[model samples]
Target: MKIGLVLPVVVQHPSTRAEWERTAGIAEVAQIAAAADRLGYHHVAASEHVAVPREIAVERGGTYWDPLSTLGFLAARTRRIRLATQVLVLGYHHPLEIAKRYGTLDQVSGGRIVLGLGVGSLREEFDLLGAPFEDRGARADDAIRALRASLSDPAPSYDGPFYSYDGFVVEPHAAQVRVPLWMGGRTRRSLRRATEFGDGWVPFGLNVDELQAMLGTVDLPDGFELVLGSGRRLDPLGDPDATLRAVTRVREAGATVLGVSLVSTGAGHYCDQLHALRELTGQAGCTFDADPGHDRDD
Candidate 1:
């Protein structure tokens, strides 16, 4: 099984200016990209959301940089870490645009890119963007399908309720024409859509029971995935045997990748995660060649 990191990038304010430093600052961000590459982590997943959720009002997401720009900078900084997206809501961007942006990042990063695509659930987000919420799911399908075709040479055309294009060309093409698209979410609605179209599934919040029920209901093929994470923190496993057993259960359910988002707020939180990372790696049989360190170094 492979492991990935979901770096902290949210709207909430950190308590101090130091903790408040944006993750995308050029020098600081480079350290993280390089660290992931050097440590042999498989992917550094990115996320996208435009509107900030506030009480009674929706607005353009503050504390944001364009994900494509940020990922591009990281691509330049790293040689090996795969740049995977956790979920890029499809209704917000066109297929051709995504193919252009990510394909460029893939070429720059030596083809280390995985596309995590999702039809978003937030109705407020759609309303703020002037998109009809009801049509967004179908729109997402159209965009992803079109993106798959456009990524290939002798590019394809698409016509749907949401969009239409004739003879689109995707440049800086990826090693794989269709980037491995991990579908987001695990609800039954999400599963049905994923089985029909996605390369894999990356999900959250479902418990062991919920996972089993979904498995019994869905006709999953080999290589189909259930990317798992939990609310619990991982402390370095003094007992590797028990750790392996827990991971194996998820693996038995067809998960090809398992990761944990070590929640953090300030510098103290970052310190706490170093131990968590060590524990997780040991359980997964991953080794960090160097002694674990608190700060990312340039």
Candidate 2:
């Protein structure tokens, strides 16, 4: 199975003061990402949020780095690792706008882009952005269609309930002919949307049993990817044996990519965890490769 990383600095919910201080800046983020790339990790991902409401800022911690900008910056720094938006809130931006930004990112990154999309659940944030909270699901569905159309062709066009454009072309089409669209959420609607439209599915908070049960209900295509996020931190400082077993089980349960959060007090600690992770996976006979036989660029 391929291992993907959610960089510590981008989210910033540091457990200790040392951890907080370690993951504090863009330079730190670059250093960590460069380490992941050099260590042979499959991908490095970042989260997104335009703005956080004051009432929920404390709970949310309000340190969300914009995914596009963060990934774009990392793209220039890393050579081989794939750049991903762990879950870009699709409801907040127009489809063409997303296409222009991320498509350009894909081109610059040398075809290493995985767009993880979601129907955002923050009602207040939606309100702040002037997006209709109630209709987010529908909007997300339409947005995915629009994104696929625009990203696939140089002169692209789409007609949908939420967005429409014709006789217009987006320049610098993505390096990959078809950029992978991974839908994220745990609801049945989310699963259906993924099966219907997305190239992959990224479900958060689902254990092995839960994922098996969900997979039993859907007819996953041969090349469709199932990426599961580890609900808890996969800390290398913890038990390496247990971590290996858990990773093995998840791989057996049919996850092509496992998203792991590396908790570190600093960049040095982060690199240590990554090296440990690589060793653990290597010992378990899991190999790393940019392509896993899935047609993500179809």
Candidate 3:
């Protein structure tokens, strides 16, 4: 299974934050990504939130680095490591705008981009942005379809409930013919949406049994990826044996790629944890070698 890393600077939750993360910024993030690249990690991920309410921010840490901007910056700093948005809230922007931004990202990143999208859950943020919070699921569905149309063709066009355009050309098409679209969330609706419209399903907080049950309901094809993450806190400076066991269990449960978050450790220890993870996974010699062209049509 491939291993992916989630940069610690994007979100500052207690479980994932180290002491130094409080003051960490772009340089720290770049250092982490560069180390991951050197360590043979398949991808490095970041999260997104345009704006958060004070209450939610207090709980979830309001310092979310914009995924596109962060990833774009990291793209210049590293090679080979794929860049991903853990879950870009789709309801916040038009599909055409998303297609344009991410398509450019793909171009600059040399075809290494995974557009992980979600039907946003923050009601206040949606209200603040003037986007429909209640019907976001329906809107996300339309947005995905519209994005596929806009991202794939030079003269892309789409007529959907949320967006409509015809014969308009979106230039600098994504480096990959079809940028992988991974859906994030664990609900039945999310599973259905992923099966119908996504190239992969990225679920968090689901145990092995729950993951198995969820997989049974979806008709995931051979190339359809299941990207799993350790549900509990990952203490990279702690036990390597325990981390390996957890990773092994998820791999056995049918994960194609595993996301490792070195959140509890400072940026200085990222390389150490990455090396330990590589050795634990027995993939020390592995490379970021997935065929970008292999799964072009989702």
Candidate 4:
């Protein structure tokens, strides 16, 4: 299976974030992104959150760097690694807004952008944004349809239940003919949404067996990607045998791509872990050379 990173220093959850990340800055983040790019990793992701309620902040942690700004900066630093918004809340913006913004990013990154989107769940934050939280699932479905029609078209138009628009030009739109849409959530309905409206599914908080069972029910289209990175932390540096087993299990569970979170002490060690995983995956007979621009020297 193809491998990518659950990029560090972007979003720090209270339960899983390492101690060193408390003081890590954008410099460290860029260093890790550069290292992953050089190592032929598939992609790197950042999440989005405008603001978190104080009460929820303790459990969720409030340090979320904006995905667009973070990914935009990383785009200029790296040559080929695809930049992903691990998930941009679909209810937070109009579909055309996403098309225009991330389309500009796609142009900047030479078509290396993946839009991982979701229907958000935080009611208080949704209230703060003045976004409708009640029908967000339905809103998200319509938004996906709108995105599919508008992402690559300069003069785009769409008519949907929640949104309808026409007679406008989105200059410098997405470079990709069909910019990939990856749906994110932890529900079977989320999987169904991905199957219907997206190119991939990136589910969170699910185990290998759960993933297997969920995937078994879906008729995943050809080349449909399942990006899995739930459960235990990977330690290719300290435990290659176990890491290999974990990866193998994910593959067996029908994961086309692996979103890896490695055990590390700091930035430099994180880069080391990235290299170790690359080497390990390479030696285990997974193909990285097939990725476009992987062999580029410049």
Candidate 5:
């Protein structure tokens, strides 16, 4: 199975800034990403949040650099690792702009981009963004349609509840006709969305046994892709065999990628996690799958 690393982008609090400083900017992430690429990691992903529950205004994350922008920086620094979002909330940005942002990034990355999408549940963020939170799932499905059309076809036009546009055509079409879309959620809603539209499904925090059970119950589409991301810090999961077993189980359940969040209980542990995945990916003989493309000239 393919293995990817997730970066830490949010700031927890002022008191924790020292720990956060280790990861908080483009330069740091670029350094980390370079290491991952050299070590043969398959992808790196980011997360977006306006405000989270019970988060102190200061402790909560800042408006922060956008994911695509950070990804663009990573693209410039590395050639191999795919850039992606764990889930970029579709409601935060208009579908056209969202498509444009990713299309542009794909161009920069030379088509190495995977888009993990979701209609988020953070009601407060919607209130702050002036986007209606109700029926966001319906809105999300429409966003997916708009994104797909924008990436493919010429003169894309659409009419929908949350958005509509006419005569839309994005320049510098991606090298890959479709950007791999992964639906994010652990619930039934997420699973169904994945089966129906996504090239893959990324669900976080579940152990292999649990994932196996979940797979047995869900009606997965044929050849569905699964990416089981580790929840929490990476220290406990470093044992090579346990990690192998988890990824093995996920593969049998249809995972194409396994996202491991390097947990640093102390300092300088990220490299260890990278090495661990490198070994795992090597052993698995995971084939190189080209991600959805972007315009090289854009």
Candidate 6:
């Protein structure tokens, strides 16, 4: 399975975040991403949260660096590794806005963009954004359909239940003909939604057996990506054998792409862990192409 980073320093959840990440910023993120790119990693992800409620922020951690701006800067800093939004909440923005913005990003980055999206679960954030909460699931489905019809098409048109637009032009539409849209959630319904509307499924909080059982039920399309993670954080540098076992287990659980978060003490140490994992993955019998794209103008 191909490995991708759940990028550090960008979105620091209190439980998983390393101490050094508290003061780290774009430079640190770029450094790690550059190392990942050089080491043949598949993608680097950033998550989105416009605002976090004070109460929830304590638990979720309020420090989310906006994915678009973060990825835009990282796009200039590195080459080859796909920039992914580990997710953008669908209820926050209209489909065309995503198309115009991220599509332009696709042009800027030479088509290296993976749109990881979710039907947001935070009701307080939804209320704060004035986004519909009750019907968000259905709305998200329509948004995915709209995105499919709109993302790479300049003169895009779509007639959906929640969002409908036609006869408009989105200049600098996605550089890739069809950008990969990976849906993120932790439920069977989420997997079903992904199978129906998205190119991939990135689920969290489920164990190997749960993931395996879910995969068995889905009629995934050809080239459908199953992005999964090991149950706990990996310490490839401290424990290579355990890391290898974790990687192997996730791969065996039907993960086409392994989403990883490493245990690190600091920025330079994080880079070391990245290299260690890359070498370890090679030993685990997982090989990845240097460049994820075949038709890039890089």
Model 3 agreement with the true structure over 87-150: per-residue lDDT tens digits? 9999988988888888888998899999999998888889988999888889999999998878
Where does candidate 1 have its weakest 10-residue lDDT segment? 10-19
Residue 233 in candidate 1, Cα distance off native in Å = 4.2
At residue 188, candidate 5 shows an lDDT of 66
The runs of at least 3 residues in candidate 3 whose Cα sits more than 4 Å from the true structure, single-residue gaps closed, are: 235-237, 263-265, 283-298
Q: Global lDDT of each model?
A: 0.66, 0.82, 0.81, 0.89, 0.70, 0.90
Better of 1 and 2 by lDDT: 2
Question: What would the per-residue lDDT of candidate 1 be over residues 1-298, giving only the tens digit for each residue?
Answer: 6666655443223332234355435554455556656656667776777875674223433454456777787888777777888788888787888887788777777778888888888888888988668977777777877877676544657777667889655666666656777888867877777777777887777877887888689888667756776334333333445445655666666566776444344433443454456456555665443434522433
| TM-score for predicted model 6 compared with the true structure | 0.96
Candidate 6 yields a Cα-based lDDT of: 0.90
TM-scores, all models, native as reference: 0.79, 0.92, 0.92, 0.95, 0.81, 0.96
- Candidate number with greatest TM-score: 6
Worst 10 residues of 4 by lDDT: 289-298
For model 4, the stretches where C-alpha displacement exceeds 4 angstroms are 289-298
TM-score comparison, 3 vs 4, better candidate: 4
Tens-place lDDT digits, model 5, residues 162-252: 6788965766555568888899987767777887778888876566676677777777776666887654434434577766665565567
Tens-place lDDT per residue, model 4, 140-240, is 99999999999999999999899999999998899999999999998999999999999999998987777778888989998899988836778889999
Candidate 1 total steric clashes: 1
How many clashing residue pairs are found in candidate 3?
A: 0
State the TM-score for model 3: 0.92
RMSD over all Cα atoms, model 6: 3.2
Ranking the candidates on lDDT from highest down gives 6, 4, 2, 3, 5, 1
In Å, residue 238's CA in model 3 sits off its true spot by 3.2
| Residue lDDT tens for model 6, 1-298 | 8999999989889898899999998888888888888778899999999998888889989999999999999999877899999999999999999999999999999999999999999998999989999999999999999999999899999998999999898999999999999999989999999999989999998877788788889789999999997767799989999999899988878788998999998878888898788878888777665644422212
